[model samples]
Target chain A: MSCNVDDSDEIFDDDDDDCSMEVCTKDSHHSGPSNMPESCYVKLTADDIVKEQRKLIQNVVELTKLPGHTARQLLQEMKWSFENVAVLYYDDQDKLFAKAGISVNGEAIDAVAVRGSSGSFVLDQQTITCQVCLEDFEREEAEKGMSTASGCGHVFCNACWVRHITTQVKEGQAARISCAGETFVEGKRRRCNIILDECFVEELLRGSGGSAEILKKYQTRLIDSYVNNNPTIKWCPATDCTNAIRVTDSFDPSSFDTSVECSDGHVWCFNCLDEPHAPAECSNVKEWRKKCQEDSATSNWLVAYTKDCPNCKVAINKDGGCNHM
Target chain B: MDLKRLKKESVELQEPIEKCGVTASPIKEDLSHWKGYILGPDDTAYAGGKFEIDIVLTSSYPFEPPKMKFNTKIWHPNVSSQTGAICLDILKKEWSPALTIKTALISVQALLAAPEPDDPQDAVVAQEYKSSIEKFKATAKLWTERYAKEGSMESIQPLLDMGFSEEQAKDALLEARGDVQAAVEKLLSGA
Candidate 1:
């Protein structure tokens, strides 16, 4: 759904049934102000996020006729916008694939044919050396020990590939882990820019007997990238809360009643992600908060909690709650 | 995994490569800490000087770029004079696993020859390099002679023979930035 503020009133009128009952109750509870605009949002649990991501990926896959992983890459590149992915797939198929770094119709495989011819070699009938580790493996052992990503033919031993993938994933770069093999261009060797697809990463990790913890971490990073890249959704700012709020209608930042509540009863301004302040604008609230922190916060606490000595006129705080003194 | 790749790279670096005079070796038995040496490129202000670099590799060696900074102080637009921090693309965001220590040091050597003043780490040096090319070359050459070149202590002996204390002579020489005539004039003026 588009979040254009001008058409939000009309859209809300036409789809009043789509608003959840919890949002309706929240509107009634916050009926103290007349100028506040009604806002609609849904609280998404952890399972809901996973389900929503899968549903969106499935829609893109069906519409574009691309594989699930490629569809996911396109969605991520497009910031989880199904409409944009569908439209771009029909309008400019090659541009969309190239932008998302997906090889079109196995064309990248063909380009690697010339580059890989010199990088890998067969040594007699017994052994071949892996370029990365510089180790010789038996011919039969090389076949099972070697692995290559989908888009490129530059092969490395399974151990090296696993190490590279795990390191990238550990560093929170799982979203765009590129191939480790270097390509020769104009007699100068440089890194290949082809990204390792998700399917290839998962398969390599599983086939190489990688631990489950690394796979879990990699998947978590992918999910985090999805939420972070999309603008319409934000994780609830409350500590230890895994729930997120997805705004269903257009949100106007100028209006002050953009407060949203999570499943844990934590209320926050959707615009600034701070505590809800109904009358004040977000910028004014930020200025007032900064002013308090800079000028009056400590002195205000002293004034409220301390008493002045009669003779010395020094401010003294009473630590114990004893009435006799 | 990192140890194996580092071991191989360390062994390969032992063989002297021609044309690029950059060498690095582990500081101790631990392969993670290394000391690098780069000979200043010819036909530049930094010529005939040797620059030392301190390199520290993390546990993820090739997958992550090694952190390198100059141990020897040289005046350049892209290197911090106070902290020895270097600003280079290959050392940061553009780093790839294909780049080795020798290649990174070679890039550093090339940075000395051709500096990108517009994108600078030291603003004063960049401004000097931009505003006056001749003055920048003179100061850079003086700094190279005072700091990077060996036998620099012997160059300060002439000022000591003129009745200036050793500390005073060294301070004046540094304040003059290795200009012999300027150091002599400042010592004579007693300012």
Candidate 2:
């Protein structure tokens, strides 16, 4: 059924009826460019959405053997899809680890081997210099707080990591906290900018210490990554709202005016991110507004060059004695 | 992380640059900014010309690349003539903590010696350099001689004769790097 947006609330007001009541619908068979096969709006209960997300995160964590934050990061990096992550995981895990920017020795840290029987980060007794501070520390100390990129294994001391993380966090560069990775490529020494895994930063902050503000910022960034990375989900654009909605049929680009209200009554267009502006298509509204603003100069010129007729109520040019009704 | 370590790194950077004869000094009382001069590498079109550079370091130094820009006017494929921005890969995405201000400056100098038109900063310069190598070389050399250095003291005589104070003409000549046309504009700008 085409949702008549004039009374859109009534269409979604029946919470008792299961949106999943009908299965496997191929909506909009017209095959025209303007109308797409929009999936029936499935208003999932918030609890069910949370459960599905939790399960997805758990699956990623289990599969990658990465920490919770890093697992979420990886999942988000893959655009919240298991298929992409799984393909990369099986295709060539080394490249994946390098891309993820987590590693100990130029190799992907096999979770089983590292935590075997001990349930700890495996450390071999070797002193290595942290590239940031340029100080040599024991491997045990390295495990506790030192962090390195997965591909280019450059380790930095814990103090340095905390300071750097704090600096980057303050600078609003939470998304790309990686190794200050400089390497040789095609005989030229260049910056690699490999991605740093969230697990390493979390472990460092947890072990060495972190301020509540920084920790909170990291947590917020972690949550935001999901919404920002996933193409089909949107965080409710309401003040103090902690909810996000994921549209199942996210591929419909033509549904720019599709407004979906959250459980909190905060409604926004699913595509264009404005109010539910019915009786006016998104393109028309934009064009009308643009024309009004853009023609101000020409309108002023008209007022300056011509005078309006008094009795007839029509604009009349004084110079040419031209009058219009 | 602390002031002492940061100071140490800055000192380390200064010594290498000075030793290489590419002098750089802290621009302000705080070590946040630096000014550098690289005499365009010899045997290149920009030889005998000095180009000044601005360097800004964030608190996250050694971890992040320092922001560098040319304060002196230059004409080259990789350097933006208007903005004085350089488009070297090492200065950006491929930036590593391992690189110091010295290496970056050296890379820029090397860029003057050999520009990569395939990846260019100023598209016009890149296009000209690619399509006509001789024309590119002539303009680059002319710009080097025209604006890169303080022209001969004798060249200020004409400006001094143009109903201006001796000091004013000399100053304008220095500001304009001896380009007579530019020196006149500099004098007018002052007035």
Candidate 3:
């Protein structure tokens, strides 16, 4: 008859439990936004995180799903992702790639690397779609060594770029290795201090102590960057419209702006428009604007002034009116 | 808006309108629209007469271009008789973003001195200008006298009798340089 606890004991115990549970729940609710939903969040051991990352990589592979020939060809290429990799959505016709949350370390990688013989890495079967040709590699004719700048992760084949960087440094034509997506400060080439790499590699090197040489190298590299990063500047790309946009970092070929100057002095910005520049620097500049007076004074399209119509009070702007008004 | 550049352009546009003796005054109440005047070019039939024109600034005023039409009526190869339409390159393909109102007005003045007969808005006048230069000059001169001269309409009854509309008659007389007889004869023949 007496499985029930005594009245005094039951009352005290129930009160303590109620207060503890309330405190616990309040704290949990307070930290709710910081935590992912249970299904999305798992306590990640170091190995578990790596495995989950691998699964994410698999998702990219599944998404791309290249045809048989393309997949095989990509496996033979040297393209690769280092770490913090994710799927980058690309629109081939426009040559635009959307930014995604998946990052390889702090830097974002578009390509993934597969380990090759003797610690070498070849392009992963999944990510080696050559952005240049806009097609998968079919034949592997050349073995071109390549590297990326630590600051801006632009990739380039050695044969096309190495001499240009060396010459700029030799001639004092450049101060740093600056490219479209990234800019490296002048003076010394740091060892491969990329985001994912924990230790500097012995093979990596920096400055030869020549400003001119660095300039030449960077300038050549900069052109390569332009070639890689900007496809919009080639033409208006508007259907059937034949306007071509001249590339300038600070200048508008259509209008004049004396204040904005391109870093290389090769381009100028106008009051009306701006040309292309290294994306990193260009994005920092504020949205393009023209003064109201400047635009009104310079615009070729005439605006008709409107007064409230006497009969209807509707705004009416007359196009070719004489001062007869 | 770039204030410095606008100031510079305003200065540039103002100087020539004042110097070339053209009407490039801004609207008193609004700077967006104004009336421009052109002293008909020297040695042309329109010479010795002053013509009024309207200039309206557009929303896309500087980048695209403002629309300008001659308000004054004169018999010219390129001006439309019915609507005072002006034909000029800046209004068409040669438009540039940097052009100012003064430069455009100056261009209109230059067009007055040398109307392009080949690209005429008034085909009949263009044909006259091309095939019979002297006749074209005389007709233009006569039209200037009747429509543009600034005397009085009472002295210009012959012009009113011509098929020229009443408004045209009045406008021609007002624009004529005190030559009622020439104005009347020209209006009769042209009408």
Candidate 4:
């Protein structure tokens, strides 16, 4: 049998004249029953064609109702060699028919086909099946699963969908998150909320391996804040003393560092190299020193009352005027 | 289920079409059908040939297998001799929604690398595949040389010239390791 090139062109572009010419000739070839087989044509026009299509669709529904394997096998057989496939389905035991137009061997014909009973169509309802398992609503409630990409209505169970998303994210290829059978706009589709969804999930449950470092940094920030805001901190200035710092306003040289009483009867500041002690505390020591000079009887008592000089590490002795001592 | 979410997902699906190397462009007027082409597999008898194929995307694309039919002439055991129907499961039962145009192209390339003998689209090729391994490989090579080679359309004339049965000439060319001249001579001697 010769294939008219023009008929092939009709498959891709319907408007070209040269192809239409060949199509015209091919049509004429089909019109003559004198050259064609009788088995090729069954007389059912208009109403009969619709009835036959409904019958075929009903057959598909019956086969789909059998089992999974049976449904799939029935689906595979839906294709016809000729044009025009009519699909019929049983709705409430009443048959509804839809016809598919096809071009077979350069001949435009109608083939009757059906989307097996396994497929469900409700008014205003669009349902998708999982491509992996080829299952629709039987696994769980429809509300619980994630639907496939746009234009394609395949759905996956939530757990399966999450796992798929996670794997894609981990691979650094999360941009592709389409359903198995859906086709998207070429050059226009972009990956969106999938990345955001992944981020939220990652926040909810810390991942196994790499997140420990982030957690550690957060803990360190907490520690730094606590220490800076604490109330008690003081710094000891003496070179020989342990560095004990407290967060307080009171300044006690004896508590902080070594202290010294000057020859002029004042407490000396070692840090500033100046005299800034309380005037009462400073002059009283001087007065006490003079009183010790006048009375030899006060010597032992003075020694018992006065503490050692913190700067020089020497005991106070009134007998020696409390300086070299 | 939300409209916004649906719109966002559709935007994501268009990405692969740009990256797929194959020209699988759908007419702007109708998005369901597309035309694509693949270069012949290299380092084989079918080098330098270009093959055209039609891709029909259903509403369930990415989730269901897209229908693929060859628009160009090809001679392969895994593709139907008459209808150019392919026997790959990725296009049918084993279809995954995650597969992209780029991946599908790679799959087609891989199909060329390894044709499935167990599930041959053409039964005669399947028989040849089962009974004689050497004959099958040689015949496949011959078919490629004759049908898929660049400017290989010349191979058709020799069989017709020598009045050799097209099938036998193809087998002989395969048996002769795709040596066109030798295949022609064999046909001439038989005549």
Which RMSD values do the candidates have, in order?
11.8, 13.2, 27.0, 40.2
lDDT of 1 by residue, B107-145 (tens): 788889889898888888888999999989987887787
Across A1-325, the per-residue lDDT of candidate 1 in tens digits comes to: 0112334223223333433324433435654322334456767777667667767877786787765667888898899999999889889988887677664223231132223222232323466556667677787777667655555566677777777889888877777777766544333334555567776677677767676888888888887777777888888888889888887756666665888777677788877788888788886885576557766877677668887674334668875311222
**What's the candidate order when arranged by decreasing DockQ?**
2, 1, 4, 3
DockQ of candidate 1 is 0.27
Report iRMS values in order: 14.7, 14.2, 22.1, 28.2
TM-score, chain A, candidate 3: 0.19
Query: Which candidate wins on lDDT?
Result: 1
Comparing only chain B with the true structure, the TM-scores of all models are 0.87, 0.74, 0.70, 0.65
TM-score each candidate: 0.73, 0.67, 0.32, 0.32
Local distance difference test values of all predictions, in order:
0.71, 0.62, 0.42, 0.42
lDDT of 2 by residue, B85-118 (tens): 8887777655666567777787778778878888
* Cα deviation of A120, candidate 1, in Å: 14
lDDT of 4 by residue, A1-325 (tens): 0123344223333233432111112244343312212232222222222232233334443544432222212222233111111233233212211111110111111111121111121212355444333345542354434332211233444444444434334333322222223222222221111111122223322432224444343333323222223223212333332222221233343443323322122333333323443333544555565566867567556566776565443456443210221
lDDT of 3 by residue, B1-191 (tens): 22333344455556543467574666644466677777777788887767778877654444335678878777887787678887775664344333456656767877777788877788788889999998788778766665565753445566656556767676555545436675675566664
Q: Is candidate 1 or candidate 3 better by DockQ?
A: 1
Q: Name the runs in model 1 displaced over 4 angstroms.
A: A1-40, A55-66, A82-132, A182-191, A263-265, A287-325, B17-19, B151-181
Question: What docking tier does model 2 reach?
Answer: acceptable
Q: Flag the better candidate by TM-score, 2 or 3.
A: 2
Best candidate (score: DockQ) = 2
Query: How far out, in Å, is residue A94 in model 4?
Result: 48
Error of 4 at B64 (Å): 2.2
